[model samples]
Target: MLRLSAQHLHELAQYAGDHGVRVVTENWFALLDRPAEVLHLLEALDGEVGLLLDFGNWTGERKYADLAQIARLAESTHAKANYDADGNLQTADYAHCLKICADAGFQGPHSLIFDSAGDEWTEIAKLRDFVLAAL
Candidate 1:
């Protein structure tokens, strides 16, 4: 199944490349969630596709380690943040994730991801500020 998925991604990436579009995958998918799986897929694709690492994905004890392993491969990132109803940032987790990416030399744009119930622009701005500070 992993091989099949990799093959399909390779084909899609090739097609997108032909039209000058870069193909990137996020860590949200279950099949590609593990560090080893992600590395395997990248190897199968010959590093042709870029990774858009999502900070919110891959929960559990090894989340940080898994993210650190793949951080250097990311061309871009989804800086997803969890917020309380009152709009308080979960500083530790977000900051740690940012640190992991930074330590891995991930020099890429962090596209903010916030879906808390509040004023959209305000929340986005808050997230952006937090990310900048953390980075």
Candidate 2:
């Protein structure tokens, strides 16, 4: 399955490139949940496609390390913010993720992601402020 996906992605990337469009994939798919798989796909593509790292995609104890492993390959990022029931930001984790990307020399654009139930603009502003401070 991974091989097949990689082949398809490579072809798609070629097609997109012909139209002057760059192809990028995120680490959100179940098939690409692991760092090795993501790396393999990128290797198969041979720089034809770039990665859009998502902060909230991979979870658990290895999340940070996993993200660090591929941070350098990212063309952009989905800076997804998590919040508690009380609406407090998960500062330590988020900041650490941002720091990892920054340390890896990731200078790409960060697309803020906030999905909590509230005024989206306000939540986005809060997230933006936190990201600014962290970076």
Candidate 3:
């Protein structure tokens, strides 16, 4: 994520019109909670610096913060992950997260995450297919 912030993000936004990666995903809670600060940084960005709402990475306090601020910047998103003891997805209201994005006017081929451990690609792909199928 740091490689993205210091280099890719600003550059991608700057060169958005030229790249197919016109949108980006970022850790939601990592950005400032104050609306002004968030808006200021985002406004400084090129069109490419969109939101990628991660369900699993927020502070417990911020977890319940209303979606208004983050939702404003979303174009695409990620559901991250919430798995059980068996590595199956936890029974959380994932649909509510999707609703938040939808209400914010994002139309996403949103990602669903699995293990962020080793060889995450195969698991991510599998989860992605599953989430797609479920949706």
Candidate 4:
């Protein structure tokens, strides 16, 4: 149960603002796994926070729907991908994921996040290119 209190988040947001940086969070924690929780936090912070939507991060039922609900608030994206034995993306639908972000008007940076064997850079490059082209 990864958690960050609203007060702590507000303090961090203020600190980041003072330093000329924006604070963002990812849905990589149980506390942030739900759309309502994320929205509530953003509202509590007066929308001073940014969200980093991660593809293929949230699993279980209605994954895409949940993602879309959060994507609308996305300031950035973690374009994570899964590759097959032949080094091809197989786990998730990149186009579907990208489309959701696009529909939500997310035009920020797409950071590649893929953990696999073989050439890391090569896999990253492949995902990067795919995301870029998709965007």
Candidate 5:
């Protein structure tokens, strides 16, 4: 199963490239949740695919360092933000997180992923504006 999965990813990357579509994998799954494994896969793919870095996907110890390492290879980003009912971030620091991304040289377009107890579009717009300012 593991081998098949890797093969499938390679095949998908090849197919996407043949069609002029870029294939990017996210670090959401166990197989890709670590920096070493993610780097291994990226090396194996040899630019056949890119990485989509997600700010909120990794948690626990070393998340910041792991994110910093992954951010260096990011072709795209999911700049997710979590907020309280009052519209303030619960605990995550958007500025610090974005600074890590910037320091790692990630200047790609961002996908504002907002999780809030408010209107979705409104929250998206708000987060988008914030991310725009930060970037």
Candidate 6:
């Protein structure tokens, strides 16, 4: 599920691991200003826990944190297809985001967020390609 903050990622991760549920955290850019904290949490996570990392959500304040950082904290991701500037919808930088996850060696599907005329299928396809290319 796409959770709200990084504050409870580790706890949630551990819980998911224990319960045999695949966990994927969201709103990750909330902690981008303090990446060390994110790193610490990711490093401590059990492999079962992953992230639904999203580039669209990273827009507001931490727009510059880079993809490798995000990838390091993810196993899965939310392949968002829109960009917002001053709250206006625009095209997303999906290619670049894919590269980021690729560079970091993530090999999982990227769950899609609905946009335009697509379902999770289009996004999932892109995410799969990203995984194949990246790994």
TM for every model, in the order presented, reads: 0.93, 0.95, 0.61, 0.88, 0.88, 0.58
Tell me the TM-score of model 6: 0.58
Candidate 1 lDDT at 78 equals 92
Model 1 spans with C-alpha error above 4 angstroms:
85-87
Per-residue C-alpha lDDT of model 5 across residues 1-135, encoded as one tens digit per residue: 345656788899888878899989887767787888888888877787789998888877887888888789998888888666678864456776788889988879888887667788987887777777877
Model 1 clash pairs are none
Which residue pairs in model 2 clash with each other?
Answer: none
Ranking by lDDT: 2, 1, 4, 5, 3, 6
What are the lDDT figures for the candidates, one per model? Answer: 0.87, 0.92, 0.60, 0.81, 0.80, 0.59
Clashes of each: 0, 0, 0, 0, 0, 0
TM-score-wise, the better of 2 and 3 is: 2
- Candidate 4, residue 94: how far the Cα is off, in Å: 1.8
Off by over 4 Å in 2: none
| Clash pairs for candidate 3 | none
Q: Which ten residues in a row have the lowest lDDT in candidate 4?
A: 1-10
- What is the C-alpha lDDT profile of model 2 across 52-75, one tens digit per residue? 999999989999999999999999
Error of 1 at 115 (Å): 1.2
Better of 2 and 4 by lDDT: 2
Q: How far is candidate 2 from the true structure (C-alpha RMSD, Å)?
A: 1.0
lDDT of 6 by residue, 14-56 (tens): 6777888777655454454345655555555544455666766
Off by over 4 Å in 5: 1-3, 85-87, 90-92
Better-scoring candidate (TM-score), 2 or 6: 2
Model 3 over residues 1-135: C-alpha lDDT tens digits? 344453656876667757655656565455544444455556666454766666665544545354556776766566766666666655454555655666677666676666545467777776676566545
Instruction: RMSD for all candidates, in order, please.
Output: 1.3, 1.0, 4.9, 2.2, 2.0, 5.9
TM-score ranking from best candidate downward: 2, 1, 4, 5, 3, 6
lDDT of 4 by residue, 62-110 (tens): 7789999999889898888766787778635778889899998888888
Candidate 5 TM-score versus the reference: 0.88
* Candidate number with greatest lDDT: 2
Q: Where is model 5 poorest over a 10-residue stretch in terms of lDDT?
A: 83-92
